[model samples]
Target: MHLFSALAVISVTVLQAAAHGYVPLLRINGKDVPGWDISKDPYTTPQPLRVVRGTKLDSGFISDVTSPDITCSIGNQKLPPGPIQATVAAGGTVQVLWNTWPLGHFGPVLNYLAKCPSSDCSTFKGDTGAPWFKFQQDVFSNGVWASDTLARNNYTYNVRIPSNIAPGSYLLRHENLALHAASSQGGAQFYPGTFILTPVSPTTPFTELSLVCIQLTVTGGGSLNPSGLSFPGVYKATDPGILFNVYRGDAANQVIL
Candidate 1:
């Protein structure tokens, strides 16, 4: 009886460990930023490693894409703006450090930026109406995406701020999608993200800017809907990007958009 109890405990412990991991630290231009305490509050308590099962759908994966939790997993309420965390030039790089990501979770990494109307985002309240632009995305390349690459190497993700982005105080959002179990609908695990305030210097160029959009449509279907895609609005349980098989070794089967 004792041996059986020990085995059960081991299984529970392993399951718990697999369900939790988060980005505890953030850096810009190689310098650590402040305000991680505020950013991590929505996901877990007591500062670090605050991992919850999150909102799950029928298939036991995170599927509440329309919830406010989809945006930083923090409820969409006005948060008292805190101190400015870090400042960098428009073309600088931001690095995100995760506590620990399980090797079994393999998928892509994406980053988005939303400019605040105020000069200092530290004073801006939580408003979900801000327009966000995709600044960086890592798709499957050479048999690996950002998550796969991070699993083999370091726990840090580096993102370069667009040189043409307008100088302003902005909120940066980083996301990681673990599709290891996404073969069925609603099985994709999503680590939405936390927000960080970053002020961009005006020295960089902004006039010469161009926008490009790639629309992918399945063989028999019409163009994929690209309009009205907010963080909480863009993803749905039935979207091809959310329901895919990544273990098949075929890059086409795994959509990273």
Candidate 2:
């Protein structure tokens, strides 16, 4: 009887695996490290996007929502946390896709949190600061928690890669101010992890070999800028190991642009 049960379980597991067909998944919890990249195309004046070598990219979101649909909402979300590794030649327009998640889960507190530290509510931090004052305002200043995120499954935004971005590698950070929370008590409160983006590239399409990996990190720290705080500056990787250092341009004749 026990053997039969075990066989039955194995059969079910195989069936489930077959049904899913080994779908590709991206994690949001800072584990399961992953990456991707882009390359240059020579056919047109404006280059076509190509996957560069040795590049890793990461994506993330701010809310605590764990529903299947909620998790799906984060898939391919744009800007900081989403994929942004496409190549454009000199003086070309680069179109990008950015996804936004629903906002209802955050409730009425959204307005207040959006403009936090405005001499109104208190703030705090997540992994560092105290509880009561863990959150601040400037954190979400870069983003407008518009209404659409609260309504649908997918929110898309179109953007152009600036021509002036140069040819060097860059990192994009998407911060979703999920909520406010304190550490212990009367300590501090800050937002939660939302989204992140990393850029990597190797050699150009014409070059021999190039590798690039994009790294993205999302944190709860806002613009509370203290006198002695150690911020590597916003959009910068706090640690060198997590840094996305995908070099651009040709291999032998590469320019740090």
Candidate 1 C-alpha lDDT tens digits along 79-185: 33343435666667766666656665666666666565665554333225535566577767776666767666677777676665565566665666655555554
Give the poorly placed runs of model 2, Cα more than 4 Å off. 1-85, 89-100, 105-144, 147-153, 179-231, 234-257
> Compared to the true structure, candidate 2 yields what TM-score?
0.25
Tens digits of per-residue lDDT for model 2, 1-257? 11001101000122221221111112332222222211212223443222211111222322221222121122222222332333333233222122223443221111001111222111111112211111211111123222233223233221222332234322222123222110012211111122212112222111000101122221332333212111112111222111212121231111111
Error of 1 at 195 (Å): 14
Model 1: number of backbone collisions: 0
Residue pairs with backbone atoms closer than 3 Å in model 1 (clashes) = none
**Top model number, TM-score:** 1
